[model samples]
Target chain A: MITQKINKDNITTSGDTAHYTEGLQEEQYLTDLERQAIDHEVALVPYKSAAVIEALKIVQHHRRWISDDSLNAIAAYLQMSPAEVDSVATFYNLIFRKPVGRHVILVCDSISCYVMKYGDIYKALQEKLHIKFGETTSDQCYTLLPNCCLGCCDHAPAMMIDNDLYKDVTVDMLDRILQKYS
Target chain B: MERPLTQYIHPGCPPFDIREYEMTGGYSALQKVLKSMTPQEVQKLVQDSGLKGRGGAGFNTGMKWSFVPMGDSAPHPKYLIANADEMEPGTFKDRLLLEGNPHQLIEGMILAAYAIQADVSYIFLRWAYKKAAQLLRKSIHEAYAAGLLGKNILGSGFSLEMHLHTGVGRYMCGEETALLNALEGKRATPRAKPPFPQISGLYGKPTIVNNVETLCNLPHIVNNGAEWFKSLGNGSADSGTKLYGVSGKVNNPGCWELPMGVTVRELIEEHAGGMKNGYQLKGFLPGGASTDFLTAEHLDVKMDFASVTAAGSRLGTGTMVVMDDATCPVGFVHNLQHFFAQESCGWCTPCREGLPWVEKLLLSLEQGSGTTEDVELLQMHTQWLGPGNTFCALAPGAMEPLQSALKYFREDFEKHVALRRCPYQ
Candidate 1:
């Protein structure tokens, strides 16, 4: 846990996270699980702010996306300004600031995948989901986004629906894959 | 014939568990280092091994270690980072090592940390590698339990802590300085060199950041010694085997740990099972996206750092992304430029501004809307965005394929201009 920073004011300041974490009464924004996860990440690093990316990941893992309120809470917890946290958050492609669906499909669009008919998979997905890139489905089940290399170029046209990577994914495989999700 | 790095890795089956790893002689190097060697001896052996980094820039691994501020009065909490950010397009070699045998990498990291006298270490992995992440977490837990990590490892009086830090998607973090900035709870913009990561990095402390593959070679080098590792190379002074991969229209697109100086033809034909039946080879990015494209004429070029450099491209990640005859060169180059533009980090004007401009010009050519003047503009970009013009290597690396594409595939660009339509389309 972020037992390092526990301010006496009963709020999680950057220095004293213990009192703030212990005094969780009325602090309903970040859940006990979320706080605990963030604390674990914070403990790994020397500075609490250095845990911003990990903390963001933990919070986003629990909550589907990072909202303004969530970002503010993260900022307050890390003793960083909301803008500062957002600067770090927005710079990364994976940390979604907007609301995401239950599962986000990151389709690889790099050269290797492009050579292997990434366009075809992307087109088929657009038709199936009835949504273009960066759009969520009406049911909030899937968010389709164009991603860079998924690190499995050997199996080009690879993608990740949340954490499960669908490799050598074909247009025909899309239906089967989507069916498993929602 | 000995695939030291990947011999134990059996694909389809789960990666070697800790018990399996130990059974197969994992951590023997750590045991060796702890028992009979000093940190200097380990670094000297690696330096003599001629083992260069496998992550694109082939810098001498031992030489990199030697620059650290060592000794008792040196900086405390010295860091050793495993740069597992394998975002280079068409690059997946590191992923195999990261996923296939986590313990081998752990032992390699411990050796590297000990060589530099680092107190803390992190495996800075990319975000999309969720499977690798899970396996790594489990493996790390096992290492802790086995007493291979944490306080006074193997009772050698040398203590080090390890952590797995997953990066959220930023290609700039591939650069060590930018990786440092990102680790410091900031944007992934690179810092100036001279005060390099060896001296000041990661909270302004001494740090040594190495590629996952580079670090993976350490254990083997320590176990087998310098001469044995040198003999593993394909008869070029460049020692050790490299994980070379081929993607695109190849019949069997895969990665193999081959002798370092093996010919490109060998990697593309024998190991990757040659190109797909219909798709004849046109040209290829000898390495990953950042490398200049090498044509059929360059197939005989050795897949080593110097040879690839001599051929006007780099042995980046040692993974080839083939360009088949059927694929449009303009579209192919456009796709690459688009990736670079999207990932520029916008830290400096040249990269941030020049890359998007280059992508637009390529897009214009691909869509048949480009004039001959646009080609001239692109040619200008290739020069203007050369090294030292950008904040980092992002823009320069972005220009590699574009410049080479124009050289080898000029007809294609000119054809698009003359016809006002994609001939391939």
Candidate 2:
């Protein structure tokens, strides 16, 4: 369990803006298990905010998003302010601030993929799912995302549903493909 | 069935021979370029095809090549740089092209060099890509042996020498100017643009920095003609093939070759065999971790540079990281923020300080101890520090998904703040 005593020293003001303050009450947010994990892991990295960010990456990978308790626990573990961690989380695109779908679909639309017609693949998915990119299904069945190259250039115009690779796609093939998911 | 591209790998050996590659139809483009076309003709062909850069920036490839002062009065020692430092988080497309078909890249490089009158070229690869570097080096040697690399062609008098240099593994090095810095044995920070690589690159001389995959397309474009490649896609001038690496919760995860404009649903269902059992789809990071997040609703949004951006995110490196229902968004953002923070070069204050602060706030929310104020603070920080804050694209690219997450998943963040605990947990 997180300790009941919240350290005042861990609290600090946000650097970029005066309106914000860092370091909320640790106990108010963290569970005991999470505190233990933070204590064990956050200390292993460097002292810069970057190190804390790395530790948070570990937490997010497991939790899929950053939580208040995790932040406080991470702050305590890293001997830093909660605001510091917050700053790092908001700056990067890979981290998630909300829940995601059960499976993620990554489409390659880089220059090579673009030339090969990745746009068609994106259209097929939008039509089949009845949603736009960045919007979850009402039933929360799938989430569609366009992506850059996944290093599979020999097979141009490719997309990854989750981890699997699909190549040589066409509009007709795409129609038959989405049927499997339905 | 036709042989898989992987089968072309010569076991432990790096395949670089033109004859070896020609066994698979390599240099046919050079034959076509030399025999059937002039340099201006090839340039016109590429321009008409609308091929763009495969690197992070989507500049027109033909336009970039055309900038090289290519007349009898142009300066000497022009350079062609094959940017092989594939460090983008979700981008690994170049490695396959480099390792699998070194000769193709070599041919493309030669053709591009010939087009722009570049006498010297460098394949700037990341150090971690040891196999690719080795393969490219071996290929360069083989190309020389086969009279494809060194001093002149099948009697064309356009001599070019290729060298492979390994990067020290900094993500920033992937930036074209930064790569130049790293190549020149300096700290890898991106220089200001305008004297873009096309004009003042590589030792302050005229240079052309092309992505590995972009260069690989040359032979095909040269041999098949730009129109043929353009016709292969959706009849658009930008038509051609692309390779994609798919990862995350899908049943089958691997790389694939397909035509452009294919939809995300087909990729997940037919290509990736759909999501794993018992799990449902959630939002995903479209185009690697740098691009914005796209939920299921946007599945039909075309996976092209323009369309993806029109739908509000860049087609950055075309890497898609799938997210499943069981995943927590706060944790995910925190994780990605951690990467950006760790990767920050520390040259800029906003990225150095702002990224960690956001991570902290998200962490607090994730643990269920945050307030609505924390969410507001995150938004505030994202606004203040997102643009013009970093030295390179890393921090800005890092912020894309976070800003989008804030816009799309505000309720989830609020719930974490209100309840002080992750509902998913």
Candidate 3:
């Protein structure tokens, strides 16, 4: 369980940009579980930020998208400045900064997928979801996005919903795959 | 299957269990190395085995280890890294080895750590390989429980701790220095060489970064002896077997561990079961997308590091992505260009600025807006961005398929300009 207490202030300033931070309380701190996980990773490596991805993953697992408060809190807990944490977070393509849907679908359209006809599956998905790439559905259930090769090229035309991988996906298979997510 | 390198892999079988691995003489090599061999003896055995790095560069693996000072003279708390971040397009060979038998890799790492005299090791894996990661974690735990990992491994007084580090979605992280940077919790960018990882790496200490397949050979060399390893090669100095794969329009695309010097034809036709119906192979990226395209006429070229290089291409990763005559060469190159552009770390000017322009030119040619000048520009860009001109291999590798496409498929590029669109379309 998260044991960190929240400060009661409403406004948080990030890099000269002041905004109302939502989803997290004013005084943001790592939950005991998140802290313990980050500390464990830190103990393994010589430096703190070496565990940046794993730390962000724990925070993001709790909150769908890392809010500014959560980002600052993670940096503080990991002994890194907020800017350092933010740069690391933004550099990784997988870590989401903006609000994402309950489930994110990453369709790979790199060379192998392109050769294997990723267009048909991609088009079918956009039509069914009524949301183009990078756009979440009105119900906030799904957000479709494009990914580079997911290293499942042998089983071309692949996508990942959350952590599970679906490969050799045909135009007809997208619906069944997406249905399993919701 | 007779070769020690691939004896353990069986098609369609579940991941080999620890008992099954041992039943076929799995940890025996670890036991042999730990009990009998000195770290120097282990290093000399690898050198005599003639094994080269399998992750495209083909550097001498034993020589790479020899660069690090070992024992009392060597730096304390040195690191050994297993480069498992397999992100090259069309290369799934590492995945096969990692997923098929995790213990082989674990045993290999133990041997590698023992050789380098490093107390810590890391499996820097690609994030998408969740299954492989899970298997590695389980195997590491099993090895630890069995006293194969952690302190006093096999009661030999050699202790090491292994960790699994996953990179979040960056193709650049596959580069050894960039991988080190990513491991250090920074943006995945390539560091300049000369203070190579062998001398100064991972936290400014001596380190060794080896590919998954390269390290897997250690046990076989230890168990069967170096001369035996040398003889396993298909009559080449490049010893042992390699994990070769075929994908893209092949009838049965998959990976296999074959002798080091298998020909391209044997890999594509015999192992991959040939191209699919109605798809005559026009050409292929003999390695992954980063390699130059070899036409159908070159199918008999040996797929070893030296032979492939002698035949005008590197045996990069030894995996082939076939290009069927039915597919438009212009569109194919365009698709690959998009990947290189997106994956470019944007560090160097040539890669950061040039790759996207190349992609733009190719996309224009593919989509009917290409001029003759666009072809000329792409021709110029390929040479401008070739290897030695860029900071790392990514840009040069990015240019290989494009440059070769312009060479062999010149008519295809002309047709796009002449027809003002993809002629195949």
Candidate 4:
């Protein structure tokens, strides 16, 4: 509806075309809920662009990984250009620009985990999932990625499946943990 | 013996609700502060108590709060943020305090906010701490419902609003200035300090960013006298109890609330149950991964700020990653350097460029491809990336383990090159 209203404007200049085209693109990318969530974060900060990271996280949470269209929609919603938002997006490791699988497996590759033989666990994951780091399984069951400390150093060799943190993870336990996610 | 911090924090059980928290003398500090003491008095009390930040840097917490411009002239809607972005490896103390009794942290935040007269408060948590996030969200809502937050907190005529802002997984957000930048929705990059966060932070307003453990100490300092708080320290000049943790090959790896000056030996042998059966404690990172390595010879060194620093390493986060004889020092340090190289915010040239170079050097050594020249280059990079060289402490901190490892484990590096293979493998 917003895009149609903008497109039907009589004074269609090049600048106006670009403006309505952006509006239509934003309409194409965002649903009402995503827009509402972005608005909530915008209310927290001083400027709209200040919510760009939160806006990206919100959209990514809705649509699993941020596509170019999703990124542009967030850019338009937060009043930041796509390049500006992309700059912020690429800085953080967790923001998935590429598509991940049904479950994202973040394996701890930090010092403590390394000391406790996280390599063996990573190897076990590779054997079971048949995927390397940053690759998704063919069935889209999981995407394996190396992460820094999950902050459970006491229980080292930790991994997180989506929001759930798995501590003291061993080679044999991988199948059980992975099965629950699938 | 005084575990003031973890007394109410029971692990394996769900966190204490508001009622349970109050029953266990939780919000009593906030009530005490609002009823009798002024904000200055609270700040002074904390400063006198000798509480320093638990998040790596051991700056005096009250002194940090005192820097905020006070009275009607200060910036309005001044912010108080709890730096709950616990990404530091081997440093898992904050998550316990955050997950155990969240109301304790909330009550503490209210006390700290009241001290600095901050109108808004934020818990800038890291992304992976999902459980802590869920508990904090519910606890923040409970505080608002109970008149402890939102407006006219506890009817003291001072209002405080609390919100939880989860990061999108950036280690750079652990830096306070970077945290503020992240909170403002920019990339998590550190800001230059001149007008510190206390004067101008979080949307150009006076802000106080306290670590999770530091904020959790507020209510206790206010409820207990300065002398009482100081007395909690175990003979060290530093005050209050600290949450010390042990990771890696220890027979029992866990965190404990011990006095500030507990010896490294006590932490390893008594608390962490003396490393695994066959593994002798070769060396340890006295704090988190960022701190310098302390060898078995430094076992008697007290884990206080001054004592540990005097022993040639910061008592960073009070969580030691113990290295056993079974583990290879070259590989151990290499893993940490890899993390630092990837985490550099790229805002500065030295940290962004120098870290990956150092990482490559270590990787080469671990792979037995390094020479004497490569080892010399590692030494040069350490000096080049030392304090005042980079935009922030990230690069300097990255060098801590490498520099100290080179000093203590020089033979280990040499062994890899001489043998033409990693000795441990």
Candidate 5:
């Protein structure tokens, strides 16, 4: 397991103070393991905005999306203000600001894929999933997103469902692939 | 004919399968690396192979592996990243390798992971590489099922776990540090250097970031030995084969693996089948959009790292984007600039602001709406924004074609500025 260092003096109990209020609220947000990790690291690193972002990466990797409490915990652990963490998280497209579906469907639409009718693939996926790009289904089964390219120009019109990629996709294949996921 | 470096690619044969690849001694290198050589020995062999990084930067591969500190006192986990993010314009070589011969990349990755003492490796692919990603994931599963990956590979007590992490399609993600950030689930923006990816990368652990082609050479180097590999190319220092991706006005626009030090003329005439429709060749972006342009006068120049640099351009990815005489130089540069501008990632001030400014200048000049002052402004921006100014190599790379365009086709640009519209247009 990775080690973390924490500082006791920086911890405060004043409810009126914004830092203390955020800290008090964030304390409950962390998983037991995350809390322990934060406690271990909080004393040594000086908890800057960058550290908050880093912590968010770890949290999101485990939880798949950042909760407000998790964000506050990240801010507290990094010895940063929660607002600082929230701002950075919201700025980048990589961060999952809201809950995402279990499976991520990425359709390739770069120049080569474009020539190969990747737009049709996207439409097929949208129809099958009943969700537009960047929207999770009501059932939370799938989330569709358009991508620039998946680099297999030879096997154009491709989509990735989670980590596994399905290449040379057509409308027919899309139905089969979506059926399996559903 | 002399022995072809890429004898595997037949003219009319269907893409070779895993079975055919195995038949032609494909995994033989992986077996050799696993059975005979220790990880340290493999590193030494790669160091001796004189294999440089194929991903633009040309850093020595063997030397790069040595940078990772080993032993229990060092970092607990080390990571190996296969930079499959081939977003550089005219560079489609990695996509071919991933689609055509993924097992070769798998074998290479296994050897590299072993050498670096990394337990986990990730192929950070370009978002545009969906097909390649699919092929690679399937190959990884095959390797895992065969015990070539996962715990105790080939009963050698060495274990590796490989993952395929696809990018969201940004040119900047090709930068090693930015690639690392993207892998760790951040916005795909280049990171500040000092702590280069080798020392601190991928979940803040020691990482070795290698190009797809560079890693693919590993099994071959380990199997055939360094001396034999060195003899294939012309220069004593330059060793092994390069997958050359040729594009634009050439008669044949495709990728071909050739020995290093082959002349540009040979590549153009023999491999590329020369210019199409009897069109006269003007200039070429010798290695993708990043390198300086090479004119017909430099056709005799050898296509190697050192030779290209001496002739005033880095041999970046060996992607030759050729241009013909009928194409207006101003318009071509404008098109390229537009790509650079759109894909700038908008992270830094100069790249976000300067690139579009350069594009506007180029467009105005191409449309005959500018004076000579616009040309000077373009040159100034190109000089200011490259190398030292940026957080990573992307902005510097974006400047290569523009700088070279201004230098090689100043007269054409001047003509556009003077006439207020291109003659060809």
Candidate 6:
């Protein structure tokens, strides 16, 4: 399984907030698993920085979200500057720099979805989850976000929970779909 | 009408295994090309076939190959890239091709690599297509195991290495040069032309970037010959079949590889089984979200590049996004603008700043907070941010539906403002 259950107990009290403090060594940040995964992706690409996105994804996959320390570790491992890797992390839509809910639901809000009355579904999801775009639930179980076309326009009003796509979604179906995730 | 291109696509079949693919003559074109024809001969045959790029811009495919410098006089280690970042709003055909039969694309890439003498190639896929990405990786490895990739095949000296690189969700990366920048781990912004990908690309080596559907056509062109390919088109101007799709309130919303010049009327009424009950087609974006809106009058327009162009819209990706009478056109344009604004890589002044401003104006108009001046301003800005003005095609393409909406649906804009709220509401 690509997504292993991250230990929430360790995450909350790790004292690894996004803010960086002085005198923290680079080696103190990354785990052995993250270092190995980033190294594997770096070897596949021609340039060390070319693996930045994939490297960040590997880090996020394990950590749930990238903190400043984790970002520095990734940059140090790839031989890229910390700021260089941060720009990639922020610019790309998928990479989460801040904490997210356990499940991220990316709702498609482009032309096809709009024509299919995506507003109704969006309202339904917001009301049920008590969060709008970019907000995680109070329980930290789901984050609602608007995405561009997911290329499932043939089945308009589509969404993806993590990597799995749920198509032809309706307000009635949202409850059952969300049930499968959390 | 003949479905030669999508013949291997059996709906539920596993794509990772090459055995079923070879049983139905999958990589035979690669075998024939490697064993018999010279690289120059293969290039000539493709040129004769007149296959155009299936990406939004319909540039001639074989002509693109001819521009690359090859042999001892040229740069070493030329690269080939399969442009699989199909994120255009109304476009989903490439994903269908990718998920169905990947070997066809693999064989097509090998043929293109041989023609351009590219030793390294990359499939720049969009990150959201997680399933398609996984399937492509497995299929590529299967090809390598069978000796169809990496140092060659059945005693042939030609060698190529193909890699699958996923884009971290940027629409600008669909533009060829921007895609190159993204692959190199820089900001996904469009690069200047003249030092085109053919001459200088991907680590400063010559590169050829072909769309996924465009590359998928190669194996068929080689196996069946150029003449047979040309005979598939409904008109003289276009050749081969195209994968056309219809979305939004259609009874049968789907995509199919039909003849090149199929009429817009046939696509709506025949293929898509017409619009849904009680929902008359108000206006439709003829090709994806980035093309001009054509009304019921242009239903007879042939859905080919030149014909659609003659009717005042480009046949962009051959996929249509239909809007019904009940839907609000202003709100639709606002939704598209928001998308363009967010996706703007912030490369140029006009695209970065202008799109958001236009989107804000559209939002106000949709909320019944606009004057007549706003409509005129939108019309002017469409021409201002047109093709030659922007850094790349992204901004110009964004203007297509907006500009045409102003022309066809000016009354809808008036209704929202006149009522001080959405008249539809």
Better of 3 and 6 by DockQ: 6
- Model 3, stretches more than 4 Å misplaced? A1-27, B1-3
> For residues A1-182, could you state the per-residue lDDT of candidate 5 as single tens digits?
21123243343233223553344545555677766654543432222433444466568767878766566567665555545566567644456778888877877654345434566888777777788888999998898876544544435666778767786788988767877776
Ranked candidates (TM-score, high to low): 4, 1, 6, 3, 5, 2
Candidate 5 to truth, TM? 0.74
Mind giving the per-residue lDDT tens digits that candidate 6 earns over B1-425?
57977876766676636998898888899889998998889999998998999997888888999999977799978999999999999789999899988888888999999999889989999888888899899999999999888985667988999999988788888989988888888878889998999999887889999999999999999999999889989665888999999999999999999989999999999999999999999989878888999988999999999999999999999989999999899998998889999999998999999999999999999888998888889998898889899998888988999999999999999888788788777
Give the DockQ-based CAPRI class for model 1. Answer: medium
On DockQ, who's better, 2 or 6?
A: 6
TM-score of each: 0.95, 0.68, 0.94, 0.96, 0.74, 0.95
Regions more than 4 Å wrong, model 1: A1-28
Q: What lDDT score is found at residue A147 in candidate 6?
A: 91
When summed lDDT is taken over every stretch of 10 residues in candidate 3 chain B, the lowest stretch is B1-10
How big is the positional error of residue B226 in model 2, measured in Å on the Cα after superposition? 1.9
Highest lDDT against the true fold, candidate: 1
lDDT tens per residue, model 1, B100-170: 99998999999999999999999999988888999999999999999899999999998888988889999
Please give, for residues A17-62, the per-residue lDDT of candidate 4 as tens digits: 2443357656556899988998888887788889888888888888
**What is the lDDT for B12 in model 1?**
87
DockQ of each: 0.75, 0.04, 0.63, 0.82, 0.09, 0.66
lDDT of 2: 0.69
Off by over 4 Å in 2: A1-182, B1-17, B235-237, B388-391
Which residue runs does candidate 4 get wrong by more than 4 Å?
A1-22
> Which residue pairs come into collision in candidate 3?
A7-A27
lDDT (0-100) at residue B72 of candidate 5?
A: 64
For model 1, residues A134-178, the per-residue Cα lDDT tens digits are 999999999999999988899988999888898899999989899
- Global lDDT of each candidate: 0.89, 0.69, 0.85, 0.89, 0.74, 0.87
- The candidate, 2 or 6, that scores higher on TM-score is 6
**Could you say which candidate leads in TM-score?**
4
